[model samples]
Target: MTTNESIGDKFISHRMLSSFDINDELLQKLNTKGFTLKSEIQAVSDDTLRLMCNLSDEQLNTINELIRKSHKTIINHLTVSHIRKLSGNRIHTSLPSLDIALGGGLEVSKVTQICGEGGVGKTQICMQLCITVQIPEQFGGLSSHALYIDTENNLRPERLQSMAAFCLESYPELKQRYCAESMVSNVHLFSCNTNSRDLFELIMSRIEHFLDHHQEVRLVIIDSIANLFRYDYKGNEFQREYEISQMGHKIKSIAHRKRVAFLISNQVTYIPVEGKDTPALGKLWQTYCSTSFLIKRYGEYRKTYTLKSVNIETDRHFFFQITKNGIKEVLPDEVVDAIINNNKL
Candidate 1:
């Protein structure tokens, strides 16, 4: 039996790929078709792959399993002490009640998925995080840069400008230290279009450049990870799920291992019944995420509900409203009641 080491998450060495069930003709087809890495084979669509490689159903299933094993089994163990060490570099969302609801803040090396309907302030929270992640550690930040991947073309510069101004005004001592002047520069904002393929290729291909050069970045925010799939991929559930789930897995592998935090916003699909709707990408992604939250709009108030969390209550809810400054705290119902009672008095 031949053995090969995992090279930067590779399934097997390119030369040893033929040691398996792949015939010479099939291997030639794969090489000519430019399928090198196991991840590439996994990421490609089955229909397109069929056209390219003319693979039978059995062969395709085998290849799929190989790819899955490559990524999943390659990293099958993590010690508790290792996880504890990684969890130390937590980044606060800076919304006090929301922070309390989150049991502290977003942990380093974890995925926090925020799901909500359109206009539910998911992007607003992302924008706020891009700023908050840079706050000095004394004030509950990682004191590092942020990487913003705007998949739906929603990285609002005007909003960042206004928010940065507010941040400077709010944290005058930090402003005196000149943190605000270069805040946006530390936060790399990228706007990706509707095509998921473009987004995927961009991340996988260009990751080394940014990830290596920007170790200072502690948070990566994908403003609505489900946006590209929602508009496209109608009637193509398998391909959509495969691509999205694989992308999710890849992002998790990179983010956690690099000790960087990920905040991904997922859109919601309405159910028109009880519970109203659920996260758009379904249960695969719901569980793929370390913690899942949902945002709902009511009149002028928006409530963020935790749908899934390992260490926090799923039933817990936090009230917040987006203001010009950024995602700001809003009075809870009890606080509102107390205010009304005081006014009556």
Candidate 2:
């Protein structure tokens, strides 16, 4: 609902100013001098701010200290205590090898971006998480619901149905605990067009209410966040870039506040000469990504996935494949060929 372009941009605010010991007159004076913008105040020298607003040296020093605290509060409210408490409560993705690689699964209060070209099983992985999150926690689930923003309009219920059927057969007790229909229905899908701004608004508005009222929600999936901005503002590069960064901030804020895991699929970009590839939005988008996983085709039926993150202890790279029952570990050609031959069995 807060549509102003500069709404979340200011790390400094009137609230921060009023919280200080400064009088109303000086605050009014600071306001008159157009010191409302955090960047403007942060850019100008403290001496300059003092000169322009006519402040005492002691008052200026206090204001600067308060400003730093305010920025830290607004930018990152995560305290050491909160991190310690939530450390063990991770969202296990339900894939054994990936669970080991991720040290569990996708983590709450952080963003995990899955990067890969088209048809590389990115969406399949997201859908799997959506379904898996419904299982009870003791059985590797978050026992939660999910919000899926389908940017590409590619979320297929048939695929989900098939996957859910597999889960029901494999873990019939999980099915008994919670009905299959309930799990499928819990994954609320929102179709977002190419307008990143609208998509952002949709997400921000629903994030709090969804998590608060629907206590089952523990995951948020934005399948291909890069596409919305790419299509809408192709010529207006500046606006496009701004929206992307702002969107990232909003998503991170919601994830941390709600303590929900974010699975964002991103389009892959690469350098031909170096044979290096990364997500499309550049480092600006990377600032919020707690973990990044890149997917590349290995041979024919297999795909390679590499995990990278400064926060995590180790990097994991492995081969997997898109199969009838969602993503699974790749098997050797001989093993696969033998399995395919009914006579050999």
Candidate 3:
């Protein structure tokens, strides 16, 4: 039997059931019972296996032991050196203060979420990272490609072109190795205008395949994962949370195994109890990300506060602004000077 290996050391499809010592007849029965993925088999109850697949007690125990062993093979056992090597490998946001607040920058092999209300530059930051990730490694970038899954259709190629041009101008040396056209082309965009289930399927089924072909892609941006589920699961909060959890787990797994950074943008919802807005999708959704930031807009400037993080201080914030060039840090001195001048007027 032919087996398909997925990210990490796990078998993805039911074709790998043979690895568990299952005969062809039983494998066919499992497939006919709608257990097509290795995960599905692991999730099934022993009673279900007996009643549905006609597996004896002995067979069940053997399959369970094999599944446990299969799982153990993929469990990462990191050494001090491995941890140290991973610590330094991060994708910079190009804004020094923001990078500092982020403990270097958007961390690779982790899921980082940015939540904000409308016009707070969530998508802008995402677009900026898409370009920044492509910057050459010599310039302190990952020198990698980006995959943008646009849920709100907010990604504008013209804006990316302008940002890429500005990046080239900032690093004139980059002009020799990269052009604005090439930089823009490296950012692959996919529009998912459907509901949350479609988005989930895209991540579960197609994303790995796409990443397999585009090995250079080290960053995946999902601009506004909140939009799709906000209204779709109305009055069905449990289902909404369940779907979000599944997607988050898959994304986190992919990020870890592929050594890619996932920058997810989310919307804010008004919490009447707190008398303020907080990241949408509830507290359950927040646990999935390794780090999360909340961006707030104030006129032309924006402040991003760390809601949850591993390396950075909680509630730590830095100011920034969106210009024709892209995201630029609003230094403390600049903010103070502007306040002083406004007071005098």
Top-TM-score candidate index? 3
| Model 1: per-residue Cα lDDT over 77-139, one tens digit each | 433333334344677785776676555788776678888888888888888888878888887
lDDT at residue 228 of model 3 (Cα atoms): 88
Q: Candidate 3 on 1-345: residue-level lDDT in tens?
A: 111122222212212354565667766776555443454555546896778777778777776776667656533442334333546468889778667755688888777899999778999999999899988777767999999999998999999999999999999988988998888999998899988888879987889899999999999999888898899998998788767766765786677668899999999999889897799988767756767889887667787888876455688888888999999997867766666656421
Runs in model 1 lying further than 4 Å from the true structure = 1-86, 272-275, 334-345
Which of candidates 2 and 3 reaches a greater TM-score?
A: 3
Q: Write the per-residue lDDT of candidate 2 for residues 286-328, one digit (tens) a residue.
A: 7667677888764344444555553333345556767788777
The alpha-carbon root-mean-square deviation between model 3 and the true structure, to one decimal in Å, is 8.4
Winner by lDDT between candidate 3 and candidate 2 = 3
Task: Tell me the lDDT of model 1 at 48.
Answer: 76
User: Which residue pairs collide, candidate 3?
Assistant: none
TM-score of every prediction relative to native: 0.71, 0.71, 0.75
How far is 160's C-alpha from truth in model 2 (Å)?
0.8
Alpha-carbon deviation at 192 in model 3, angstroms: 0.7
Q: How many residue pairs clash in each candidate?
A: 0, 1, 0
